[model samples]
Structures are given as C-alpha cells and as structure tokens.
Target: MQFATEILTSFLAIIVPFVGVFLERGCGIDLLINVILCCFGYIPGIIHALYIILKY
Candidate 1:
C-alpha cells in the first residue's frame, strides 16, 4: 500500500501540474506542493489529487 501510494503520488506529481496549468491557465498547485506532498505524506496528496480528478 505504501509503495502504491508512492507510485501514485509520483505519477500525479509528474502529470497533474502540466494539465492543471493548461486547464487553469498558467497557475496551479506549485512544484513545492508536489514535493512536500510526496515527502511529508502521500495520502494528503492522493486525496487532494483525487478530489481534483473527481470534481473537475
């Protein structure tokens, strides 16, 4: 589960930024947010991205 969380968070951290930028027009959750998310904890990041994914 930990490994899965790591992979998923990394994947979202990799792809979501560009998509977010494109969709939102130049601004989104910054890179620091991604790094902190992966480092501090994956669950928060996963939850946040999931909400973004599900909601929008």
Candidate 2:
C-alpha cells in the first residue's frame, strides 16, 4: 500500500518536479540536485526521483 502511494506520488511529481522526493525525504542535498536536474530536463528529474524513491 505504501509502495503504491509512493509510485503515485512519483508520477504526480512529474508535474511539479521533485515534489514527491521532497515530501518523501525532506530537505537535503539530494533534493537540491533533483531541483537542478529538473531545471535541465523533466526526464532527468523523474529518473532521479525514482532512484531516490527506490533507493531508501
């Protein structure tokens, strides 16, 4: 159930970028990098978010 919620949050994060990660992990360097990646491109941001979501 939690995993499903996380997946949904990750998908929704596509719109705002890194929001799901931030919500999951809170403020940190990883979040900063995600924000930067999001600035570069949406795909990178999504990839990074998935990595973070699955990693820990």
Candidate 3:
C-alpha cells in the first residue's frame, strides 16, 4: 500500500500537481489555484507542486 501510494504521488506530482498538492498539502485555495494553473500549462503546474512540497 505504501509503495502504491508513493508511485501515485510521484505520478500525480508530474502530470497533475493540483492533485499532488491535495495529497501533500490538503485541500485549500492553493490547491484550486494550482489546478487551474495546471490546466493552463504543465510547467507551471510542476513549479507549483515543487513549491508546495518544498514550502511545507
């Protein structure tokens, strides 16, 4: 289960940082905004995800 969760988190972090943020940081305005940014561009999503992970 732990392995699967890690894999899932890793995958989500790259392709869908909003989901990754939710998994790592919990639901909030930041999650919503990041999701929108992801829809706009993948790079921004990645940056947002990394920022969230590193920030907290």
- Per-residue alpha-carbon lDDT of model 2 for 1-56, expressed as tens digits? 99798778777677666887898789999899999999999899988888887787
Candidates ranked by lDDT, best first?
2, 3, 1
Per-model lDDT: 0.47, 0.84, 0.81
Which 10 consecutive positions of candidate 1 have the poorest summed lDDT? 17-26
Which has the higher TM-score value, candidate number 1 or candidate number 2?
2
Each candidate's clash count: 0, 0, 0
Of models 2 and 3, which has the larger lDDT? Answer: 2
Give the per-residue lDDT digits (tens) of candidate 1, residues 8-56.
6446534653333233233545434544565667666555454444444
**What's the lDDT for residue 10 in model 1?**
46
- In terms of TM-score, which candidate is stronger, 1 or 3? 3
- Candidate 3 local lDDT, 1-56, one digit each (tens): 97676667767788778878898878898898888888899899889887776665
Give me the candidate number with maximum lDDT. 2
TM-score of each: 0.38, 0.79, 0.71
Highest TM-score: give the candidate number: 2
